[model samples]
Target chain A: MTEKSAQRRPGGRTARNRENVLRATAEVLLHEGYEHLTVARVAAAAQVAETTVYRRWPSKAHLAADALSELARTDNPIPDTGTLEGDLRALLGQILALIERPEVRRVILTVVSLATDDDEVVAAKVAFWESRFVGAAAIVIRAVERGELAPESDPYELIEDLVAPTYFRLLVTGRPLDDRLVDRSVELALSRQGICAAPVPGRPASPSADD
Target chain B: MTEKSAQRRPGGRTARNRENVLRATAEVLLHEGYEHLTVARVAAAAQVAETTVYRRWPSKAHLAADALSELARTDNPIPDTGTLEGDLRALLGQILALIERPEVRRVILTVVSLATDDDEVVAAKVAFWESRFVGAAAIVIRAVERGELAPESDPYELIEDLVAPTYFRLLVTGRPLDDRLVDRSVELALSRQGICAAPVPGRPASPSADD
Candidate 1:
């Protein structure tokens, strides 16, 4: 590729080429995972040079970050259901769907790993969450303002409680983010019935110290 | 430098030496962080051989993991005040204290990152949480038995809500784990007063959509 090609698209062809490169990167990441992600493979799959790929992104982490950012751009917004539970269910359901997607899940893990060590990547991840998480926060905030949530509640903390476990499951257990799990989580978070009450007979039971 | 020497401590050397090794490793981590952690440097600082370190831990991460595991074990257990809120407050307070340690926070983030991609490392992480979260869950179970909690609650979910967000803040936002945050979280997870109720004035407005 030419020097100019590295910075700006020669034409619409360049834009299309960048998209193809990103698409192929996501595909490889989904199929082979971050461990196998390589600039050479992306270039080959996108029919571009290794240099071309590197020119656009400094590292595989950077590439994956870009792809996730692109994915979030069109992410479905949580519906404006008037009830907190309904809205939470919808929102959690949507997040669950995204978490369940094979490639998307891999990308998410990859991005989180990148966020852990790299300041630049962390900045990017924070920016993405600032937009996306903030958007989610707005929905909850609206619910709180409308007397649907407790008066003393903080929406940020509420979001942390509601959504953090799902991400924790993703990172720690690799648990299936199915509809059932999402439903239960949403129910527990929004109702206070699940978290506040005592033990259920048939549930997993309290984790013992022996755990 | 012999294999036997590497595997065993030299006859009755200062116990202070071992402490120095751990302290030096922590200092290096605070200065350079986990990504730059090296067995060679740690060994040099401790006045131990590379072979000695190798015999003890196969990798830098393993060394760090052991250090962290030991740190967590040394921390005080969650206090029992016969109230769910008090117990959680005590547990979360200990956790926050761990994160506030000079280099401990970075070590945890490093572990969480490794856990994302490495299942063995995650298993170690799981073992770590089992000590904290699972142990806390036991308190809730006992509370249920004592009729302190509502009869119908799920202990696992309750524990999940209580502890999950603290881990989330550490891993996600890199936020300092503070008592105020823990207090609010415990209050929300334990009580129905603020979280699930319809929003009232000065609070976020109520969710309009009823299920």
Candidate 2:
């Protein structure tokens, strides 16, 4: 397991080349937007030969998906603050921050357009989102276990409700994504699911928690 | 305002020219997408001089906004089924069908990207959404008048709550927008806003109406 031995290991060069190319792809996409993106620029940025770029990725769309898959692999950090309300806001705020990035916004539009035409891209994106939902579901599961949320609560739907308005405003309605919108989104998602009946955090509770 | 006089009116030719150009813009976008879309092609399809297209719209983005403005103006026909639930489904169904169109989806993605970069596009898009919201708000206002929703209900938020998830799934997550999702969205919007307590259609109620 020495450095030289590791470098000579099978698939090591391939993995390293992938890392460099994908990193370059993201940098070009972020700074230049999608239209300015080209295989030549990416190859130059990565310091890899154009053939190496083509050998790994058949198309720019595939290259973009590789970068997005990397993004989707980033763990959805679940904030632990002892209440479902705080947890949702922290998780949602994290999402707000991610989507608010100008580069990510540009990247997402490209991904969405690709998803529309290509089945493989659609499947990959759906799987990516499903995985993210599983991560976010941790907060809801903890609440349900703590007797804050109903046992029947569907976490995917809950997360979708909390997150959808922001995406809608971002892509469709062109509304501002601000703190007020976030607060209302959290409120609506919780209250609609009947989790709003939970007693206030410092209040004394009766024997019947349902009330 | 007879038909012949209307056609002979001062703005009539201008109106006809606009229709031709906008239709041409949409055809090119649907057939070729945003990349091949150029003023020359649009002018050729529109049967107008290229200078005419330039005089009317400064850029391809401007031409796109004008076409999108037309789509947004098609009134969101508020369905008048008796129940608020029925009305929501109808509105949501209409939205689902529109977004499902390949052409509309392409147009929307282009418009969203343009809005991000151009001030004029942003203003035009924001105004268009505002108008659509105002039209959809009619359903909420009717429900309030029928004593189903609270009088203080903000229609825009309510509509946004139901519609955002659909757009999010379509453009961001690439999830299916089906009947189940529509039902859940409607239920969540109503329950969260405390509008789920209304009496049944045939139920007799006290004059006080607080029961």
Q: Against the true structure, whose TM-score is highest?
A: 2
DockQ, computed on Cα atoms, for candidate 2: 0.31
Best by lDDT: 2
Compute the lDDT of residue A97 as modeled in candidate 1. 77
Per candidate, chain B TM-score? Answer: 0.60, 0.72
Question: Docking category for candidate 1?
Answer: incorrect
Q: Relative to the unseen true structure, what is the C-alpha lDDT of residue B211 in candidate 2, on a scale of 0 to 100?
A: 26
Candidate 1 vs. true structure, TM-score: 0.61
Tens-place lDDT per residue, model 2, B1-211, is: 6977864352867777889998888778776777788999888988899998888687786786667666655624778898888998888888888877877777766666553677766766776677677877888889988988755567788888888888887778877788898888888777866633322233332224562
What candidate 1 gets wrong by more than 4 Å, as runs, is A1-63, A75-77, A80-83, A115-117, A137-155, A173-180, A191-211, B1-70, B114-125, B141-147, B151-155, B173-176, B192-211
